[model samples]
Target: MVFLHARGITRTVELPDAEPLHILRGVDLDVEVGDHVSIMGRSGSGKSTLLNILGLLDAPTSGTLEFDGVPLDRMTAGRRDRTRGRNVGFVFQQFNLLPRRTALENVEMPLLYDGGRGFWRRRRLAAEMLERVGLGERMAQMPERLSGGEQQRVAIARALVRSPRLILADEPTGALDVETGATIMTLLDQIATQAGAALITITHDPHVAARAQRVFRLSDGVLHAEEPILEPAA
Candidate 1:
């Protein structure tokens, strides 16, 4: 399935006294179900901008984006919000878990907005997801109580608890040490693959980008595909 499609996606922002800033220009991307793709870029290269647009958190200034073949340009705001909420998941560089909430409670937050299950059912699903991420024993721990990697796992569990068809991760491992980052990435990819969800990662780390099957470089508001660096056979 074509989980996400974008063509001629452009984003422009205007400062009060300046010309419009073109953060993204004519960018096109396609992601299929269970595909792992990564975008690598320098700071201020608009990688995060593109991610926000793709995740439906922000609308493009021009061009079209479609999710599961449904054109975002044609949907009303309410419909778009519901569609985004149900089909898209996001993980950020900083673990975005609520500081006061336990790992399980944080994972359950999405279900509260979804209203797809009863309170007890939501708790069960969140618990199962936390367990899947190897944080089963830490479910009651607060974000501050967990290590950085453990906190990220909690974030991942929260992102996947709803089983979104598309997962957008922006600098997901940026806060971790080299070894921890690799472990987190591996765990993230494994879970996404098991869920059959398309994963799009935006990162400045080439090593992290190399983990994806397809890699692209975002430069000066444009995205260009780079040859994938394949791993040797075992």
Candidate 2:
């Protein structure tokens, strides 16, 4: 099933005393359930802007965006917020865990906003998620006490706690060592697959981009699909 559809999506930022900058021009993408996609671009290539639009955090300047066949512009602000909160999960390079919160608490934060069964059983769900991420023993550890990889694992657990249908990972492994980053990517792919969630990763690393089923390169406010590099047979 198609989870997201974007057509002719464009973003423009108007700066003071400067002409409007076009960040995305006529971007078109279709992401289906369980799809693993990667968008690679340099530091100022507007990759993050596209991600923000896809994740429903921002609206496109022009064009249509549909999530689950419903147009984004058709939804009211509250409905959009509720839909985003319930169906989208984000994992960032910085491992955006709350500094003062324990791993468990950080994971439980999302459930707190659910206001349903998830809210009532947030503790158990958070614990299970942390355990699934191989951090059961460190659930009580503070962000400062955990290593970089461990902190990222906590962030991943937190992002997956709700079993969101779509997972957005931005430069997910940028802060980790090569080995740790590889491990994290593998773990992320496995978990997202098991949960039947669409995974979209935005990165500048070719190695990381190659891990996705489909890859695209963003340049000069445009996105172009890249042919996947095949592996040698054993």
* Highest TM-score scorer: 2
| Winning model by lDDT | 2
Q: Note the clash tally of each candidate.
A: 0, 0
Query: Compared with the true structure, what per-residue lDDT tens digits does model 1 show for residues 102-136?
Result: 99999999888875554558999999999898999
lDDT (0 to 1) per candidate:
0.89, 0.93
Model 1 Cα displacement at 68 (Å)? 0.6
RMSD of 2: 1.7
lDDT of residue 226 for candidate 1: 98
Off by over 4 Å in 2: 230-234
Worst 10 residues of 2 by lDDT: 225-234
lDDT of 1: 0.89
Please provide TM-scores, in order, for all candidate models, with all chains considered together: 0.96, 0.97
How well is each residue in 162-232 modelled by candidate 2, as lDDT tens digits? 99999999999999998899889999999999999999999987777878999999988888999984532
Residue 118 CA displacement from its true place in model 1, Å? 5.9
